[model samples]
Target: MSPQQKALILPEKQGNFKVGSRSIPSPGIGQLLVKVHSAALNPVDYKIQDDGIFVTHYPAVLGVDIAGIVEELGEGVENFRKGDKVLAHGNPSIIDQGAFQQYSLTVATSTAKIPSSQSFDSAATVPQGLDTAIAGLYGKHLGAGIAPPWAKTASDLEPKYPIVILGGSSSVGSYTIQLARLSGFYPIITTASPNNEDLVKDYGATHFFDRHLSGRQLMAAISEVTDSPIRIVYDAISLPETQSVGWGLLAQNGILVLTLPPSVKEDEGKGRKAVSTIGSPHVPYDEEIFRSSWAMIEKWLSEGTIQPNNYEILPNGLEGIIGGLERMRMEQVSGTKLVAHPQETK
Candidate 1:
């Protein structure tokens, strides 16, 4: 194996990305060295480059989703072999584990083997998206405190409530819609542009609202569909406008989960709360919660309970990611993940 690999690096805070050589890190205990075949882009990747957030180190390599072949294994890892196909939640905080490189390292706790039915490009879209859904729906403190459907404690819920997921076409939102269905949430309502209504419904959203609808219009429209009070709203978009719509729709004591910082303040003394999700499994608080979800990912993907986001591969390998991030920043990307093959890096 080569001692060095190509990587796209942010030379400094808020700096442009440049392709350069980086050392291929050795796997640590309970870790696997992966030769990344596919790396998916996220909105946060652009945000990091533009706003210089998340990474506290210099020359950062920012990427979270990963799917590839396990080139080697570290000590005490028994579930996988050296040549297994795997999908993992790469820890972007550590440059060596970032997925923008050809070879990356992933802890066994957050890695899962890809089923034969799935491709590396498709699997690349799952890690961050699915983990965000799990964090928003099942995190004891961060989420609505619902039992994970896959867990033994899962019940039909004391009330079998309905849920509203804003921006259902997004990667995170698509997975949220599916997980909502798995949790037995009836009348799974979501908001997306008209073009993506079918896409959201395919992911199990029972009802879809045009994203352009006013808060009042959406509230009245949803009321016509179901009388159930909206007890939970996952605002995957979390823009100020979308957050306001979600906050207005929530019944008292409901939770509003956001992927971004809350721009809309919650009303005081309404018993309604708004919280944000940190999707990385490497976070100390999220370790146990994320590990529990990661254990079921392979089965979920294999059985078709969880569908990957529709993805479009970018041209030019790792170099292609530069243009891809620009498109995402401009909001030109919709309804599909942008995937890049690091092996094609030049």
Candidate 2:
């Protein structure tokens, strides 16, 4: 590999990212130097690009999801080795920054072994959204069959039962559907634009309601699917319209899990609850909760339980980051992930 590698660089806030080369750093303690094969773009990527609130250093990288092979392991790192395939979400809180680079360094706990059946692009797409799903759907009880990384016991029963996933057509919603199915939840219901009803159905949604449909009609559709009340709910896109509709759909004694902020009262009737299902290590930008999700998803991906959704590969490596971000900003990229590839300089 070449001593210098190219990465997408955001020179400043509201700036267009350009391609530039930098020296690839060697592994540090408990870190791995990965030769990134691909980096998946998320809605947050465009948000960060627009605001640049998290850019501590100039010419910073801005991708979050990464898939690659471990090029070198830092001292005392035993779980991986040179050339071992892996996938990880580069935690933004750490000084390490992002993955829109050829070589990225990340903590071992934040990565997982990628399944052989999945491509680097697909593997890159799974970690962040899947982690969100694990957090939103299973929460603390992820170990009980659909156990997320934080589960300490496998005997825990479903909490705030009868969870519903709002925006089931999203990447996070896809995983929530799969995990809910694996967790033995009956009658998983979801809301999407009417066009995506068939796609949501393919993801194992027992019932599909259109977000554009009237509130009365949506409620009637949901009611026909389940005899029990809806308890736990995860809203991927926590916009006011989605949450307002989702909250009204929640049954008595229900708990709402929102990726964004909630619009309902803190407590519902009959011991019901509503809270944003945020990951742990919440203080001052710690992502310890994400670490747990990464590990648990590794096992699930390997077992073929979860699958990555539609994606479009972007060529020209990090140079293409701007174009990809532009497409997402305009909401042109829908139901498909924009992934940038960064190969080793041979």
Q: Pick the candidate with the highest lDDT.
A: 1
lDDT of 2 by residue, 1-346 (tens): 7888887777777687777878887878888999899899887777777877645666677777889999889998998888989988685544343788888987787778887788898898886777677666555432112344245465755552455788888888888888787776778888888888888888788888876776678778777777677766777778777777677777765666777656766555456556665432222332545555666766777777787877898867777767888887786865677888877322
Q: What TM-scores do the predictions have? A: 0.98, 0.87
* lDDT (10s digit) by residue, model 1, range 1-346: 8799999998899999999998999998999999999999999898888887888888888899999999999999999998899999987778988989999999999999999999999999999999998999988777776788877452445556789999999999999999999988889999999999999999999999999999999999999999988999999999999999999998988899999998877765289899998888888665677888899999999999999999999998999999999999889999999999999986
Clashes of 2: 5
Q: Which candidate gets the maximum TM-score versus the true structure?
A: 1
Residue ranges of candidate 2 with Cα displaced over 4 Å: 54-57, 93-97, 140-154, 158-161, 263-273, 278-292, 344-346
Report lDDT (Cα) of residue 301, candidate 1. Answer: 95
